[model samples]
Target: MSDTLEILLTNDDGIDSVGIRAIHDALVEHANANVTVVAPASDQSACGRSISHGGEIGLVDHELGYAVEGTPADCVVAGLAELGPDPDLVVAGCNRGANLGEYVLGRSGTISAAVEAAFFDVPAIATSMYVPVDETPLREIDLSTDDFREARRVTTYLAEYALDAGVFDHAAYLNVNVPTPGKRPAPIEITRPSKRYEMDAEATDGSVTLHDRVWESMDPETIPDPDGTDRRAVAEGRISISPLTAPHSTNHHETLTELAETYHDRVATADD
Candidate 1:
């Protein structure tokens, strides 16, 4: 790694979003990084790792970087394979909302971008801020670059030093979630993704409405996540950094082995 970093910066939010711009400026101005922004042209949040397979992915030159007509994952694939220089690191987001649970790991476009980079043997970081639900609806809440001050501070620190610190030696990528800044700055904490799952569906008039009940319980007092979990850390006004691997890990099972061994015998017996 050189003193100056070559970074591929992207996000699930559109390139015009404040969060992406905040992070992009932070890395370049603070981390002394040369950043190439290859982000979605439109909001692609929660699109996960879905790519435009066998389809054309359009790219437009923007003042900041390239605006990709695809998902967050596609931005990374394009950045690493074609659009940008071979980056030392790939960063996805300063996303609008928090992605803090195990269930969200496979569903968040912000995190999926980082996961895509890991497959290319590059270190990556996925960042998001936990927005508190208030009387103002989430969609109506307007956030500015000021809202991302803490996120930018933390992300820039890591980007500047984490590589030389060997933070990525064991972890394929990092999932970082920052709490909305308060009167005092939030402290950073290492954490694991929470396992709590609370999804419900209501069916009426031949339509089903899916609800993720977890958001309602994110209050510090009501959150059921343990102290060391990402959701809990964020709810308690701390930055949560969860080191994670990209690949799906499988455990060896004797029962599955035995089942495989009996497969031909069972088929023959059924035929007989």
Candidate 2:
């Protein structure tokens, strides 16, 4: 158990979402830590950091959390700045679905919540479970403390030790996805985010449709990936942990130096 660390937990799912509850309970039980849950009042999946600057924000009180009327990013900004004193860590998700691959990095509200935390210079982790479709929403999955037993186990282990172990030395955040614990519990491994994507769009009558079909298009029997990629390992019943850094890095590049010099030369010509 962690010794009384302060943790701020939110999720892409609403503040009242079952996934968050499982996470909060797990942290409390496993880490024996002080935790505060401040999350959006409604489902905010895929809604990056968008928040209305002057909109009215309502609070829906819960036994374990406060549901704010805003996006996942709004919840984190609110959680870190005004909810409780700055948390030592920020944890997002235990999401009902997986967030993996390169294209998913930008589109996932679950991971976005953790990205928001990174900008604040806090260590953060995002977690999710991959559910196959041809199914109803996850609330119909008969959720319970038992449902997230392994997700919580992996999350608890990382949350307890990742920081002191410097596991995040090269990454801004960790993205973890646990396989459904059924016949067997899988091995855990460190892996990289897979860079694969496929989106199928269709237009019918006067409406267009967008579908994410990479999971469907995959041939698990053939399994093209060379191992150690998040997608392949998880497909093979392994819990995958990927450490990622915030995008949009700025550094000195010599090619850009010439471009800057050209811009200065243009300014001189204009002045002349």
Best by TM-score: 1
- The regions of model 1 sitting more than 4 angstroms off are none
Candidate 2: residue 29 lDDT (0-100) = 88
lDDT of 1 by residue, 1-272 (tens): 77889999999988999999999999999999999999999999899999998868888999999999999989998899998888999999999989999999999999999999999999999999988886777757899999999899989999998999999998999999999887676899999999999999999998999998899867788778988999999998899999999787899999999999999999999999
Error of 1 at 92 (Å): 0.4
Query: Please, what are the lDDT tens digits per residue for candidate 2 over residues 195-231?
Result: 7777889999999999877766334576566578888
Considering summed lDDT, which 10 consecutive residues are worst modelled in model 1? 132-141
- Go through the candidates in order and give the C-alpha RMSD of each one to the true structure: 1.0, 2.8
What's model 2's overall lDDT? 0.83
Candidate 2 backbone clash number: 0
The Cα local distance difference test for each model comes to 0.93, 0.83
